[model samples]
Target: MTAPRSAAPERSVVDRTLSILGAFDKDNRTLTLSDISRRSGLPVATVHRIVNKLHGWGALERCADGGYSIGLRLWETAVLAPRSSALAAAAQPHLVALHGQTSLATTLAIRDGGESICLSFVSNDADAVACYGGPGRRLPLHATAVGLVLLAHAGDLVQKEVCSGPLRPYTRHTITSGTLLKRCLAKVGREGHAVVHGALSEGRGGFAVPVRDGRGVVVAAVGVVGAVDVIRPARLAPQVRAVADAVSRCLRADRPRVAEVGA
Candidate 1:
């Protein structure tokens, strides 16, 4: 038989390592070398060698049963991502306090290349939550309170890109049409906040507000999520606003101030 055309050149070691790292995503937080090799489409030997290197570098940790997971050290490095951490650090205490009172799930998210990534998610009972995307996960931006808020205020180019693409419908309640999305975005811009119901997941309602930096431009978004029946804005709005306002103050505080001589 004629020799089968060889597959494209084997991926480089560097590319394979990156693929291994990316293989551990939200749904699959842990995996074995075999899993990594399969997911990365690299030779098992190559995966083993690189995984060892990553482990030595503290980027990956070995599981008890011999699988691997993202290490805490890696998490520490990721926390330095200003898009996620700088804002989360300022917004966390407020999120914690909010969760304490309402026992709901809350998170801090930032727009990332047309996606929304959750930096922190506070929930006493995450398993019980009907919320989509756990902590340290990325979600599609087409149907989320945080996404709408960020997309609504984003530069015209980003807004146009998001509105022009194929929109997804998560549930019966999701807003899909570009025109409707535009209107919603406009409303969010005018309102300075967004309250969305069951747009991301069934029975899951969320509200989000932009957290601005010194120049008054939004750098990140913060929000809370809970069941539809339990998401009463009359009860939650004040707290959310208070928390969001505090976060904004922090962003403003980080700006350099002119020295005043009062002596």
Candidate 2:
């Protein structure tokens, strides 16, 4: 016997709202109302209603084709998030200068939960592999130099969790062995930086250093990427470290002032 649609429990306002927003991602950038309904598994009427509200609030924008995409308002809100915003602001100038001098791709990233999200990037090389992607793109936490440095500083729990198993291989050089990866991460911790060669792509190489917060926490990573032959980690380590240090100082100087109890 088929159950009546009316017999199903109604979704909460929060759940329905989140569903509509969650329907958009890097792969699914824009979608029609029908597409949102299908992806969110909500009734069309519910999707329409929620989407209209979202559009009005500037959380979503209606396209000329009557499709919906994430709005600039939403982006503005996201960039204000303290975790990435403060770090990105501090790192931007350094990243730009590095990119200008080296003519290689320089990227700033922060660990978002389990993934590394690119916050800023500058590159002039058309032939350089897009392993890091651009700003707002997510990269694996175990494949590149930035990822390795982040994982190394992310403490034992994160290292164990990521290295336990199921590490996807992007190339033959990608470290699939949890044991070997653990060793590599240990070395990264000792060196205070990471250098990866052909790990994310067949010919790509990278060098990364940690960006510390006001409290001395490893809040982000800055790195440079290019072809394996020309990207020498040891040679570039000093420059990358200098930039990372400059950003760290900025973070400390620009951080919010704590209130005094008796003031």
lDDT of each: 0.78, 0.84
* Candidate 1 residue runs with Cα over 4 Å from true position: 1-10, 127-130, 256-263
lDDT of candidate 2? 0.84
Tens-place lDDT per residue, model 2, 88-167, is: 77788899999888878999887765578888888866555354667788888888888888888886677788899788
Across 151-206, the per-residue lDDT of candidate 1 in tens digits comes to 88777878788888788888999988888889999999898888888887887888
Which candidate number would show the highest lDDT if scored against the true structure?
Answer: 2
Candidate 2 backbone collisions, by pair: none
Give Cα distance to truth, residue 3, candidate 2, Å.
8.7
RMSD of 1: 5.8
**Model 1 weakest lDDT span, ten residues long:** 254-263
